[model samples]
Each structure stands twice: as structure tokens, then as C-alpha cells.
Target: LVSYKRHLEIMGERNSYSKTDLDATFMRMKEDAMNNGQTKPGYNVQIATENQFITNYGIYWRPTDWGTMIPFLDSFRERYGTQSNEVVADSGYGNEANYAYMESNGIEAYVKYNMFHAETKRRYANNGFLVQNMYYNASEDYYVCPMGQHMERCGKQHSVSDLGYRSEVDVYRAVNCKGCPLRGMCYSSVIDRRSIKVNHRSDSFKKHARELLTSERGMMLRSSRPIEPEAVFGDIKFNHGFRRFRLKSNRKVRIEFGLVALAHNLRKYSAILSKRMMGRNHAYATI
Candidate 1:
């Protein structure tokens, strides 16, 4: 039908769209309505903050934060005319692609991986069977199985992202997994030879990221990151009551949010100026 053709045109690259707003994607709302899995038409907003000021912002149709990282950073670079020296973000922004992007740009990434918090727990004896805990020999390019079996480098698996970025992962397969004692502790009922797909590039990136994220300066930045965006969001939504978008389409909505951010910055500046007039040395506690 004509409607199908029009919808195909509107949903060019996206999987879903709202008829009311063609550019709006149906994303899961942040608020969990009692796990009802409610979805609404909206755009994912990305913002960078420094000392509680919204420095740069972007509007994304991508629902997940990980996929939006590169585009958001690119937007920031486009606006600032240079890449950031240091980037601090939560686990949601930590991934192979993001880490690679930062490393190639010489940016210190103080980003936590998906396993960062879980790795803090005491790793048990059985946990040694996990791929991450397994010993990797860089020179040999292989992994050691829990039962002392040598998992040699066999082949590679190629993965292409939604953005069409291709990355290769080296797959290591155990030389022998038949009749191994630790087989039950490792995998399931069907006992094929044990194998693990490892992205060497990503692992290296993650190792560097872990080092940077655990340093003293990294700790301070990580602690301060929450204060930057969370407070601004609270100020705008809770205090200013500027949650709902006033516009319909994407471009208009972006402009509308820009005004909201400007209002927030001006209000914050007014508060700081007032505090300075009162002879306060530090206003709003600069980071």
C-alpha cells in the first residue's frame, strides 16, 4: 500500500518508528512501570558536563548508550574542534568500539567495563573455568583450560556492528575436551571440545582501561562524574519541571532542549554570582 511505502521511507535505517512522529523511535522508558515493558516515542539524549555545566549535547535515535558513544563524541569534537583528552563514563559506555576509538585518539578512558563490578568479588575455584579467568599466553596466542589442557589458537570470528565497523576475535579451542574431569564445571550436558572466542584487541583495550580507571586521578574523576550530569538532570527535571518536550519533530525538539540547557546554565550562573557577591571563595564547589 501507499502507507507501507511511506513508512519505509520514514524508517529508512531504524527498526521502529512512531506514526505520530516519524522521526521518533519507540524506546523503552527509563522508568520501569512495574516491569510492564512499556515503550514510548522519544529520542535518546546525550550530554557532556563539566563542573555541572552542560558543555555539549546530542540527540540520538539509537536506544542503547553504547552505540551512541562514538556519534556523541564525534559531535562533541565537531563542536569543540578537538577531541577530549580524558573521558569519564559509566559501564554503559564501555565497550570494544568505544575503547578502541579513545585509544586511537590518545584519550584516557576512565570507563568501567560490564564486568568491572563483578570482578571485585572473590573469584572462587570453579570460577577459574570462565574464559576471563583462564590464563592467556600472549606469545603463544592461546588459552589454558582449567584441566591443564592447552586451548590453541584455531581461528577467528568476525563481528560487524550496526554501524558497519568490523572487528576480529580470535577463537581458541581446547586440544582435547573428551573425558576431561572439569568438563561438568565448565560447560553443559553436550560435551563438545571447549572453546572461547576472545577479542585480543578488545582485551588489550580493556586492560589499559582498567589501569586508567583504577588510578588515583581516575578515582577522583569517577567520583565527580555523577555530580556533573546527575545533578544537572535533577535540576532540570525535578527542580525546573522541564521533563516533557514541547516540540514534535527531532530538529525542533533539539532546539527546544538547547533552550532548556541554556536556562539551566543561566540559573546556575546566577546562583554562583549571588554566592560570589556574598564573599564565598568557592561557588558551587568547582571540580
Candidate 2:
């Protein structure tokens, strides 16, 4: 997570950030791990962008990325009047609350999920169930528990993203699996119940992502990303020689990064203007 604070922006000179604001924001982000609660240094950068232009910008030193998204998105909306329909980000941005926010606000997002999560991993007991037991009913959009139980949505709050129903899918456990014929290969655990939390939110997005990833437009949109954001980062680090940050606090770091981005934009804009002028001059010479 990266951030620069509002106070930093307010106190900083044209090119530098306020030291006090940077320390405060960094402390906020690192509050959990740094229990002692001294100034834990960190930073976050926010950029409002279109297909080829950055409209608004901000930075802060915050530890977690979770709290910053909505505030940044809202700030972007306030400045730019709205945003792209589909927000594309990597798995680090994936969270239940963020998904709910997207769904509620009518914005679609393409966020990756960690594969090891229970939602994606299907558990199987060697002695208990056959391959058929793990089958997902596409028509029904539900899973069959190992014990031949139909796991329906339990009318309970299972998690933070409780859409008012929890996945009530549990395995059909016969009380006497020890004496049952297929006990050995069916389950390894003493407790025969084989039902767990299935994240439907992640599942739904994965379906949406699959459809979009295969489309021609999706391919084109994805292809452009490496060139755009990566180019900006590369130029800042390599061309501009900004590998290590000179500033310690989040606020100063943000101010510095903002300047770097601004510089890149200005250079690109200047290059475009120069090319146009050169073209006009060449045309005159030809005439």
C-alpha cells in the first residue's frame, strides 16, 4: 500500500512534501504491525486517468490498500465527474468489501484472487468420495458436498460480505463412516463433516473475467497496460534515476513521485508538440 497525506500536500513547497504529514500517514498504515505506535513510515499514490491523460493526482503514506480505494475513487469521481465502467487491478486489490462496493455502485472490476484460498481449492477425501462427488452443478450453480449433501445457502451471516446468506453446503456424513464400506478413501479426518466456506463473490468475478479475457477487446485492453503504466514506472526509476527514495516519510515520497509523474507527462506532451511543429516546418520547406 502507498499513500501521501493531505497535510503533506498543503505544507509542501512546489516540489517537496511536508514531513509531519508524511509521518502521520505512515503511522496510520503501519498501526497493526507496529503495535508500539511510533511513526511507521509508508506512502500511497493516487492518479486519476483516462485513455491517455491524468486528470487528478494525490499521494499518502498508508500501510493498507483497503481503506484507500474508496476514498481515492470518490476523489477521482469528484474531480473527473465519473470513472471507467471497468476497473482493472491485480489481486492485491481484491477484498470482499471492495467487491461489494463495486457491485452496489454499478462498477465492474477485474481483480485477481489468490489461488490457495479455500474458495478455489476443492478438498477430497481419498477413501470417502469418487471424482463424481466433486462435480459442480453448472445448471444449479452449487456444489455437492462429499457426503452427497446438497449445500444450499444457509440463511446466516458467514462473513463480512454476507449477502444475507451463507453457503450452507455441508457433506452428507453418515454417523458410521468407520463401519461404512467406503470410509477409508472417503475422508482422512475423524470429523466426517466436509463442508466449508465457498466465496461466491470471487467465483462470480472469475466467470466475468473469463468471458472478458477471451474477447478481442479484452485482449487489446490488457495488451495496452504493460506499455502505459510500466513505461511510466520504468522511466521514473531508470531514466530519471529514482531507484531509492531520498525522503523518509510518506508525504515527501508522494510529493516526489507526483513530480516524477508530472515530469513524464510534461515531457511526453512537449515531445508531441515538437513533432507537430517539425512536421509543419518540413511542409513549409517542401512548399
Best by TM-score: 1
Tens-digit per-residue lDDT, 136-216, candidate 1:
888977788878888998888898988887999888888768887778888884757887888888888888888888899
lDDT of 2 by residue, 58-156 (tens): 664444555556667777778768865876655555665666667677877665444313333455333225433365676755556455555443433
Clash numbers, per candidate: 0, 20
The best candidate by lDDT is 1
RMSD (Å) of each candidate, 1 decimal: 3.7, 8.9
lDDT score for residue 170 of model 1: 88
TM-score of 1: 0.93
The TM-score obtained by model 2 is: 0.63
- Per-residue lDDT, model 2, residue 240, is 81
Could you estimate the TM-score for every candidate?
A: 0.93, 0.63
Q: At residue 106, what lDDT does model 1 achieve?
A: 86
